[model samples]
Target chain A: MDTLRKTRWLLVMLTLAACKKPTENIKIVIDTDVIKYTALINVTDGQNGSPAPAATTIAITGTAANDIFELSGKKDIKLSSGIVTIGLRPTVAPTTNQPITVTAEINAPGYNRETRQVTFRAETKQQVINIQLTKTGSTAPPVVTPPPPVFNNVSLTFTGRCPNRTDLEIRPSVYVYFKKSDSNAAFQYLGYMDKGNISTNLLEQGGTYDFQIVYGAETYKVSQKIDQTSYNLTLDMPAACNF
Target chain B: MYFRRSIVLLLAILLRCYQVNAQNNNQPPSLLGQKSILLNVGTQGVGAEFAYGVLPNLALRGGLNFIPFKAHNVFKISGFNSTSNLSADFYNVHALADYVPVKTASWFRLVGGFAYFFKAKGDIRVIPSDDYKYGDLVLTEDQIGYVDLNVNWKGLAPYLGVAFANTFPRNKFNVSFDLGTYYLNKPKADITGTGLLEGNSSQTPQFQSNIKDYRWLPIVQINFSYKL
Candidate 1:
């Protein structure tokens, strides 16, 4: 009986030690989209579709300009790689008949000043506006090229990876830039990626392209060879997101 | 080894007391052959058990228990008005042994048991309430989405407690109160979300850390037993 009691005591101690944190190594994934009804304004050179100069500035002026905010919920929006996403602040909404309109003015050295009207309609939650510029003196008419073949629709899912903080992730809601992997051409405006998912018909079967997004002044890039209808891509956001 | 020796010494003292009482009193107020089935309800929910006196001052009990409950609007997140639905289901079957050390005061007993919890899960889903606005646009329920937090701790748990009355009926019927705790197994927890809330999954680490030490489940219960 004494031996039996000793064994029971040992068993109780062992049971207490058996408890280990089951979720110790688990990683948490979080989506990045908080603001809805956004428009991605992408500025580029009209002739070659190259990114605008680093000194380029964008100014919003209109009745609804004050209500617009960056996707990160900042009022003072700054362009990264000549791209900035503008959205109606969470407190505002657009109606079909009364669409919200804002004038986006782009100015850069040696480039003709340009202004484009961006409209946010109630029916459309996400949009992309391309603002192409012309040089001050160059009278080169906008090149009219033959339309490319209608490629199959391809969907891409972008997941942000944070190296320092493995638990932090971002389902990026930002403008996407894509270019042919073999071409020296600059990245062109693809579309607005909404919470990691974007579908476009520009990617041909078997074609390879490099996709890029500039967030927090850092350019993150990922490459994929288009083969299937859908692809999952990861963008390294080592700094993660502050907002 | 020292702990084992201390428990042995305590048991020896208790045995000596019982032996002395047996010698002084001829009958010793026998509790043996006392058999009863009890219906219980309290913090651990509702349960039914059959208790039988196996020794002059000891009884054995085995039973099953279950509790299912749900509550709403218990949580909020970051100024977002959320309607939280919390639901928990726990079902267990257990067997326990009671040792009444003092023969004169047999009502007080030390109890130990092993309970096998077949289903123990707590789930909370927080959905943004109606009138959620994103800028000027009111979001539909599907667009705003919901977040679900789930925790499961189901396995064999050890129970230890003290009972305030005889487990078996003293007369035809008797009521008893018990205070105890069960050391539950480690829990598995996860957070998932849909729509705009899908990013809430990243909060799993914080949630895990907050709940890591929640292994002890306290119980305060009332049991009514009837002798056959």
Candidate 2:
């Protein structure tokens, strides 16, 4: 009877021993200093340009319809941490882009969370990732407005010959303007010429334009005006615009 | 021989730890600057790789890497492709992990990882429009502006791929090559910025796609790392 008892104890101990490896425990003993990621409610992610709620929890799902990825060593990932990694299996492919997502909650207690959306980004090989996290209680962030279109600070105005096309190329002159205006009758010399011609500025952020076109002996006038409302003249050039 | 190799690896690890700890010792080193430098070279890449162990049924592996690549991107317009090579450089970084649930002398490794890419710079030039008759026509620099845009700007990109490698003879050096592709965002252009350094952003008068994808550039490289 004693022998039987001893054997049972030995078996129980062996089973326990099999479960633990010194190295395996190292990952779980995370440094308390490890910061957990949290964010406030944010605006739409490249969406309608509006504010949204914070995320609740991020669940890293699997690959896309025709994708593959193995999250192996990532098994030790902590849920509480901002970054939770999954494990990949051997033979699982590799990728240059990390496709992972997280879901967010708009509001919560003591924690401020935010909401965002994930869309199809053109990237290379493998899985689609999604991770949604919840936020603690906090006030929502401000709504974002669609940024006005920006123009090239520097314009490319050059004088070159027409290779094959004819009846074009009227004494090479690059038009540089700040805004467009039909005020030929308004202030005379410095009103505003629509951003109709290429090689000039895109007339950005209500500004004054200094028009100067050095063509032949004719000296066109210069004008100055505040861009209240302006539009880009698609001036419609060939697919091969060589200016 | 296997036993001898194990002893060697154990000693190597001990030596490394000893060296690291010894740096804390103010005492002069007995062996001088004879500290060995071990460079682990492997081709497992940024993804997953599997190795089989006859003695041990299972094993684990993880890899993180970043590689820089230089490419000469040719801009094609209308029907003409530029022969005047305009090149760009970009980088990709990611972490790779592998698992071998099954056991054998040569175990199959399931691999997977994430990829991050840096945008590439491209060159764009505008073909101006001066003459307009029937169809879309290109004219002199006077009539239109040549907007040459190069997508060689830098941006982050990611990727994932897996490969299998077999270790030969106990634990000699092993060689395995990997091929994979990740996402690449067309480098954006700042038309406002100028000068020769501009590399032609103001010239790209038009673009067809908003977020163009240049993800087809395949990555092929080899890996070689020694097991401790």
Candidate 3:
């Protein structure tokens, strides 16, 4: 009788063990990166260096105009807060000897019309074009400021963070802009950050600054104090979190 | 198909051993003080064990097992024609107690044990098999890149199951079969990529969720024992 009872217990244990299926719920997710070659077009008020008037419009011309589209893959490109990201269509790309070029024309009701040449080279996937518009007839050539004073080289590695997704991190490949934290001066162009890393001598020790990047018609900003030679900074980039 | 055939063969051998042992109705000798060394192979890989009889109906065994395996194109992603390379490494040390309950069926035993897994990890890298094109440009492999999924389950685990034969050798030599499973520690999973696929890190959350419950490692082994 004891042997029979033990057999039954063994069978029950085996049955329970067999009920667990470990791989049944496993799922694999794959995401794609579409827009590879892009250019950021930034337009600002030439007088105070503020964002262009709310009504400013952008148009693409030249032979390659038809091959260009907004970062969102829309052909009807317009400036949002005076910034827009334009890219070559997924079916179009530049070759080593043949670079793709387009003319971006900016227009505002009270500002002079301006056009900038945007080029997409095979070697460089990202570029930034800055356009400053001056009010009609009040012409002093657009302010050309002297180079920033040389300072200690500071390396900033910017990581883009997704607000809703804590596990995801983004290494942004885009142009950066910076301004002194206490100054009202417009954000000045910082060099392009290649895969989240950039080293520049424009920052001074014991100073605080705000860094910004404009993408998909939105501007994301992060602030840091330049007390160290190397720092890792994070920005809330909702636009880059679509994946 | 090979695994199914192996299980069938093992069951046939177990039945033969039972028939031979049942022909003699005399009570089996006490196992106390008996010792044996065993070599085994099965789902958990090859291993060597040392077994000692500690009580009339119980024996204690300690052993080590390890398996390092690699394969290609074993994993697939739907809608993505990619080639995957998979590798797994598992090494562990375990101590178990085998208990016999009924005198008439001394051949049957229940096993309970604990194992410390020193190394348990699996990695798979998926690379695009075709010529990848970005826009109109054909990209090199370095630019197209690959995604790697890694999971590690390295910790203490508890084991339970049954054996179909006696734990100690009956005479000079004997064979036995063990069927069991180990409940491993929760696994940690992550995904990483290079080049254009670098954005795949965003999928780490989903990968972790999918692999959270993968803690069961089953064993089906045959042991060849020699009395020492």
Candidate 4:
């Protein structure tokens, strides 16, 4: 009876030992995003920051093997052993709103290196600076046309004033255009429209030869060359909607 | 010597119980000079069932065979980051003959036979969905929907169940209440996804069934049968 009891105890001990469970291995994954032409610098487990790819290479076309964004100031980053991985993302691609893909690799000295693609997008200014690449699309000063010879010596109480209420000197704009080449060569400067005299000037010796107005933002050129008589010059303001 | 004597005494007591029940439990051997034929009739799923005196120690059980299951009520899924509330309806049915080897007065009845499970799919919710990426939340009143489900048998299951029937002769009619457990291995059940649960149950949107791990279904049974 004693031997039988001893044998049962031995069997129970063996069963308990076999039932001790083992530890399970777990896997971890992390994701993030960035833009082009910019650097995403993340501080390592150490005091220093490291670039996402560890180094910059041009072959980073897609998110396959070795595609990572470059960081200008991160090189001597020291990461700890427990620090599994670090991810970096740029603000946006060079010109478009599409964000660049970031593939992260953590290579510590004595530990196994970890790698994964951190996908994300960066915010970008949607509207482009479509302003003229040059003078072709510039919004600067306008052009003027030479007036025809006023040989008629015609001057009768000439009355005119700059309609522009403000900034008449700095970014001044005129309102008239000559339809023909025989129009006036120079435009008389009537003082400020609001404060200048409105009552007429003393009648000069000759009658006035009316030419097109020249003070607005209109461009004018000689359309016709008739030398004999003082033909009236046509003044046309661009449609109000064009401004 | 001790075990042998105990068995002999137990057998003697059982024989007396059987003889007394045979003489006193059933109808007094009909003076009409006629005997009712003992027939065992069972149902396919749900109805009435009974047992009759066929011989000395055996009885034939028959009735409206009815084996029904509770419709699935609550459906839930735990995703990577969130959990969701879902709903499903399910059912079960059984039809077979029970052979009881013990005497008429024996209280325990062990019976094993065949059963069928019919499942009908209802309606699907979460429409116009091509992808399946959703967070988990409790089921709201708005997320509840109904669809008609049809249950049909894909195969048959041989099952086992037990019934305890007590008899009383008040008006020459036999009535009994059955409390039993039926086992179905794997029956065909059509499950339809409706409301919030519709999008996650299919293969295309997400590769997961709405409800998993409820293979063995336990249910409650109440039966009524009359001897002819």
Q: Give me the candidate number with maximum lDDT.
A: 3
* TM-score of chain A, every prediction, order shown: 0.81, 0.19, 0.78, 0.19
Candidate 4 docking band:
incorrect
lDDT of 1 by residue, A1-243 (tens): 254433332332222233544334444454546666888887878777777888888888999988887766566666777788888876688998899999999999999999999999999998888788888999987543334456889999998887767644677887788888998877766777877889999888899999988664467899999999999998887534431
Our model 1 lands, by Cα RMSD against the true structure, at 9.0
Candidate 3 chain A lowest-lDDT run of ten: A23-32
lDDT of 2 by residue, B1-228 (tens): 554684486556545534543453353222211111112222211333333333232232333343232222223334322222333333444544444334331323444455454434434343422242111122223322233444543545444454334322124444443445444444353332122112223223323132233333444444554444
The sequence of per-residue lDDT tens digits that candidate 2 reaches over residues A121-190 is: 2252222232222233323453334333455443322222233433222122122222244523111111
Q: For candidate 1, what is the TM-score?
A: 0.65
Error of 4 at A56 (Å): 24
Which stretches in model 2 have alpha-carbon errors above 4 Å? A1-228, A234-243, B1-73, B79-85, B101-107, B116-158, B167-169, B184-211
Ranking by TM-score: 1, 3, 2, 4
Cα-based lDDT for every prediction: 0.74, 0.31, 0.77, 0.29
Comparing 2 and 4 on TM-score, the stronger one: 2
Q: Could you estimate the TM-score for every candidate? A: 0.65, 0.33, 0.63, 0.29
Winner on DockQ between 2 and 3 is 3
Fnat values, candidates in order: 0.13, 0.00, 0.04, 0.00
Number of the top-ranking candidate, with DockQ as the measure: 3
Per-prediction DockQ comes to 0.12, 0.02, 0.13, 0.01
Off by over 4 Å in 4: A1-243, B1-46, B50-55, B62-73, B78-95, B118-154, B166-171, B174-179, B185-213
Q: Compared with the true structure, what per-residue lDDT tens digits does model 4 show for residues B75-100?
A: 11211122222222223344434334
